[model samples]
Target: MTAWQSIPLIQAEFLAGRAEPRVVTPRGDLAADEQATIALFEQARGSVVFIATTERLFNPWTRNALQVPRGTGSGFVWDNLGHVVTNDHVIAGASGATVRLADGRAFNAVLVGTSPAHDLAVLRIGVGAGRPEPLPIGTSHDLRVGQKVFAIGNPFGLDWTLTTGIVSALNRELPTDTGAVIERLIQTDAAINPGNSGGPLLDSAGRLIGVNTAIYSPSGASAGIGFAVPVDTVNRVVPRLIAQGRYIRPSLGIRTEEQLNAALSARLGIQGVFVLEVEPGSAAERAGIRPARLGREAGFQTGDVIVSLGGRPVRRVADLLAALDRHAPGDAVSVTVLRDGATVDLNVTLDAGR
Candidate 1:
């Protein structure tokens, strides 16, 4: 047979002898709840941004200046005038920072204000164009445990990552680098990490409920336990930061232990804060609040025990702090203290904290 005639037969024989491999592709529709979650993410993702900070390093040996990356974190748009909010530790030592939106746009950000006590900070970028939408603010007061929550941020340098979990707890407290305690924190299991700090923690309705601040991970990664500063604290602190560059929490001018314990109160025969030392010229001092004293007769006599303030029971130091925070400086509050088996009432004008 001719070569051309044999070619077709050879090709047909090879094709008929070969086995075909099956290829399968799987595609399924998303569930309704998943669709809603996707929609929520879409609605709020634009408000989130990645923050990169820079610090100037002085090289004494080279006699030259160099700018190096300080760190990276996440932040969200706060207002139309270009206010961005993030964790204070995000920009802790950064000389400057840049805010980058999801659309690949970046801007130089200047520090507006910072409150290390709450682990919150505000940054400002000039308004000209391409400003991300501000998040819809929500009140954390109404949030219940086990309610669905979402967190969007850069985790391990991965930007725009989303994690979903329910509110594990409320009214939690976390310590800040400044030795101040952040109160009324929202605890969640929504996979937060180092880069997730300062991002928004939203409810299922896409409203901002808290600011992701810390994680309870021993390995420096998300261990399914995280905490955020509740919006109630955020609302109170942010405005003050924007206006005054710092948050001034109300104070009674008395210093106590890191926390008040029931044993301490019981030993003192009082169910209130046992005054350790009242400031020399503080409102507490003016109100005749006394410090715990050492007595020869009683061995160790409790000077004064504050039982209540402004009609609110002060069972612990936190209660006293929360009560004081409700009023501003110069506001007169009625303080009741147990003094020598008798209850005494004193009016004290609140003073600014030192």
Candidate 2:
């Protein structure tokens, strides 16, 4: 009967019933790098925060104003004084914002200051004795392209998530929605998404190096490319924002519109910022920098076209601003301009801008 059905029925049943759970294997200690990363997260998680924004809307039916959920992002405790730092775009149009700490404490945040051009903002809360410690700041100017970096934020509403990557690039320039360009940005592939904006980008030592700002993705998600505002800029801007309620940019006291500069550059086949009007008694005027004026014979005549500032080329309005940003007010700089097809050099001391 075909070898008696291979075996006895009782034996087959016993074999099937003998099956049991497998033994669990013990996992060894984590690697040195793994342990360090885990330790870093545990130590720094308290400094990171989740930010929820709301906008006020008036309902026609109820004839009442309502606070609707606007958006959510991430932020970090800036200091023990309850100053929370985040991206300016995170709270651009929101009527109010709430900051939630890692300890599950939520506090209503007040807008302290904002620098839209730098994409940074500061908020204040009354956390009192329960304030989380601020992150340890690190210099971004010394960061190498291949060094490991960590990002902690609430990505896609996922709270307290961590991502890690190497510094893919540095000194990158990015344009903001406010039509201003932010220079010296740090680029990484750290899985930074929408909610990651305003969160801290830390180094291996758990020191803050940058603020995760934007992602270069077409799908509205992380596509292996992300940008952060370098901590050097943050350090220079945030304290000023906290104290002054605004970041004052250094100005040359010369007015130049972007559209007009572009048109004039095209017409003249030149690549520089055309000084539209030099403010009277201003730095430009003091430096003998001329401005475009109405000409009787030529209809409209272009004056001095700024070619360079402090040895840095100024081709667009953004370039000029960025060049000026490198120096503080009262600092003297060499300005080069093209006047009547001849290059001229002038000295100008910057002034504080509004």
Candidate 3:
């Protein structure tokens, strides 16, 4: 009997999370039939999958038939209560979704809520008799470029499939099915496939730092450039989805334009968002974020040009939007800006922008 811990990469990848199937007894000698049988057993024993099963339709003869719902893909049990978190796209059209856990257990999962903007979803698994291990949450805020990362999910009905790679990039942005931009994303080299969506992306320490959400291959497989929703965004968005069915976004109320042309640039004498107007009684107004200088020199200006939020420098409207996206309604932030050739700081209370 050999303890599996003796193998470094395979053992850690196995215990911490599923990394990949190890070809065991590579150097050992066994009869052909015996070796083939053992390899098959180990291969099947190594992975976990998350799936969304469709609501079964009843036929006259087999109304009582217990039809097994289809497995979605690689998903981990997020908690003992049987709530599972996965990518929203995985279960998008499924009327019935179920989670397939290790030990060959399948449970009916009700869709709790989802954030299409973030591509994250939550589902409740246990109702009759099942509780699963929930992975510990970790942060993506401080994740470095070379940090090892692991992904656990079912790829193409395969259960508990694990793939390993490193944090390939950070602060990635890509458009969803809709044209809306998904911001502050984590780019990794981890192998994510058709069945890998909604699986947890874990660090070497075995803590979840992101969720496998998208891949770059046109062929719909891992192209060595996969993206995950940073666990930090998940922490902010998921709890709200669990408590309430939606998320609240914070904003600094002002109409802005990106600086582009030399004419507008020279006219304003500054390069930044051209503030058109600030909503009266909004966060910006309260902070006395000065409306654009109107009169003869400035043309039809009424809004304040916001240059920064919470000390993060903002040179464009997207920058301002990104900073506000990180905070929720009622969070107060200090805004810095350029006004009349002077850098001024203002405190503003974010509004729950509908």
lDDT, each prediction: 0.87, 0.91, 0.72
Higher-scoring candidate on lDDT, 2 or 3: 2
Model 3 residue 172 CA deviation in Å: 0.6
Which stretch of 10 consecutive residues in model 1 shows the poorest summed lDDT? 254-263
Name model 2 segments beyond 4 Å from true: 1-12, 252-348, 352-354
Candidate 3 yields a Cα-based lDDT of: 0.72
Better of 1 and 3 by TM-score: 1
TM-score each candidate. Answer: 0.73, 0.73, 0.62
Badly placed stretches (over 4 Å) of model 3 are: 1-49, 55-71, 127-130, 253-354
Q: Name the candidate that leads on lDDT.
A: 2
lDDT of 1 by residue, 1-354 (tens): 977667687788998788687777776899999999999999999999999999999999999989899899999999998899999999999999999998888999989999888899999988577677899999886678999999999988899999999999877878776788887789999999999999999999999999999999789998999999988678777877888887777778876652344568766556888787888889888888888887788876677888899999998765676677677788999999888889999999888763
Error of 1 at 313 (Å): 16
Encode model 3's per-residue lDDT on 1-354: one tens digit a residue: 367546777667677775568778666678885565444333333223457667455677966645555446656556566667888888776678766667667777788888888888888876455444467788876778888787777787676676778998877888988666777788999888888888878887677888888899988877899999888788777877887776666867776543232245567666555566778888877888766656887666534556678878776555666677677899989988776667788888899864
Model 1 misplaced stretches (Cα beyond 4 Å): 1-29, 252-347
Mind sharing the TM-score for model 1? 0.73
**Model 2 clashing residue pairs (backbone):** none
**In angstroms, how far off is 76's CA in candidate 1?**
0.5
**All candidates: CA RMSD in angstroms?**
7.5, 8.9, 13.9
